[model samples]
Target: MKIAVMGAGALGGYFGGRLAAAGQEVTLIARGAHLAAIRERGLKILSPRGNLHVPAIPATDDPATVGPVDVIMFMVKNYDVESGARAIAPMLGPETMVVTCQNGVSAHERLGAIIGAGRVVPGVARIPADVPEPGVINHSAMWDTLVFGEADGQVTARVEGFRDAIVAAGATAVLPGNILHDLWRKFVSQATLASMTALTRLDLGPLRTNPDSRALFTAAMEETERVGRVAVPDLPGELVRKEWEILETLPDTMHASMLDDLNAGKRLEVDYLSGDVVRLGRKHGVPTPIHEVFLAALRPFKDGDPAGLAKDAVQEFRTRT
Candidate 1:
């Protein structure tokens, strides 16, 4: 299979590297220092399952250079979806499938509007991975899975073919009966973890072990589930429980990608995660107090802490104590 990873960051790099190592034709769409590192050396995967290095993998900033592929893993950050969609036009053939692996549920609609809905496949990436440095992907947990399907839940040949390819690459993939429910379920899980970890600057260890913090995390999950149900009414009533079960299985060091961005002083995905929950809650007349607080607290840091106000406040409080 010919595959192109549009973002080719942590998530994309890890999976795309796996596919490439397994003899699939994979091209990385990346830029900046990361692209430079890939071109200079190769893409490296630091994973518990196994370490992989795909030397001489085709990588470029321009999609036109790679031409069309069987599948395009659209893994850009939530904020860059529109521009990313516009940029991938040159790589879209008649039968190419664009799989969106973003954190929120809105990418399907946004990408559909730009590139035609028929070609879009909504997907949820369940993995704890990040790029601690250029050309390096740190898979924080042993769990790595991709759940995706057609918008209407049909078991098309292309979907199954991609699933087989992913399994062949040693990663799990699922074709859910209803992709919308899976998308919302992932949203509930991601939004809660992202907001809490970024707000507290802690990992799953402290958040899950501390009773008060764990309760607060549960409350945030409930808030997100409420809003999610409003969007997808047929969502399971035990969605919160399901998410909690998944959380318990994660390693102690697991944290959201948003927390990584926050620590790196890069732009955060606040508008898409917690901010989206608040916006949808208002539109559907649902109360989302927890997410509202998260939205307000993190909004200032959305574009990053350029003024260093957050750092100054922390230092001042430490000195006072």
Candidate 2:
């Protein structure tokens, strides 16, 4: 079970570090100060489930330095998808399973172009986390897990072997029944939260508790679901309705990774999540006024605004995490 985790940030750092600690052979591709810290002090995982220090994790700046691998866990943000794909070419063997644990639905398609669809697997990451600072990942929730499967739903040797390897790493992993649907459902959830949170400058807590904000959140979800159904017409409407109920239970303080990225002034995945929703809505002639408005309001903060959101005004529309 030789695993290569490309993009060793929050999600990659947590999963890859845990796998390496549990004795799975994991190679992480990272760079800059975060990479230096991992190499110097090992990976510091500040997780509620438990803390771990992966003292001997293997990492490098270039995939060529590591050579071909068995499982390639793709964790790059949408902004880097294309370049990340090109970078991974040297590490991929013919049979390697490149699992994408990124947001939205198009990551597999983009990676497939780079590494061929036969070798691509789409993965969904369920984790509430962020990199509070370089080399330190603040995982507020402990339920981080990874689910991925073959594009054709065929339990090939590669898929099965990655499951076994992830389990051996003391981590929760599964090959889902309908991987595409899983990917979309995650999109519906994330787009709603990310757009709502970033647009309102409100975290999950405030967004869910206030009736006005909560209804607005539902509107955003409906917009995402409408566009998704148009793009993937076979998706069930009832499933999305029921899924909305499931989302209600999420802690109000919870925020999407995109919101955290926006707060940090880093390049965002806007083009994929909220931006993609708007794009598909236009492509399929679905009206997405709510999400469009959200995108319009938040796009400004991504580049020039460097202050932590204004507190008094934000508190009027925000709730504490």
The candidate that wins on lDDT is: 1
- Per-residue alpha-carbon lDDT of model 2 for 215-245, expressed as tens digits? 8877778778888887887776665577677
Error of 1 at 292 (Å): 0.6
For residues 1-321, write the lDDT of model 1, one tens digit per residue: 999999999999989999999999999999999999999999999999898888899999999888888999999998899999999999999999999998888888889999999999999998878888999998866788999999988999999999999999998899999999998887887898999999998889899999999998899888889888888888877888998998998878888888877766789999999999999999999999999999899998999886876666656866998
Cα shift from native, residue 149, model 2 (Å): 0.9
Consecutive 10-residue window with the lowest summed lDDT within model 1: 309-318
| TM-score top scorer | 1
Query: How does model 2 fare in lDDT?
Result: 0.80
Each model's number of backbone clashes? 0, 3
Candidate 1 stretches with Cα past 4 Å from truth are 311-321
Residue 219 lDDT, candidate 1, scale 0-100: 90
Candidate 2: list runs displaced more than 4 Å.
Answer: 301-321
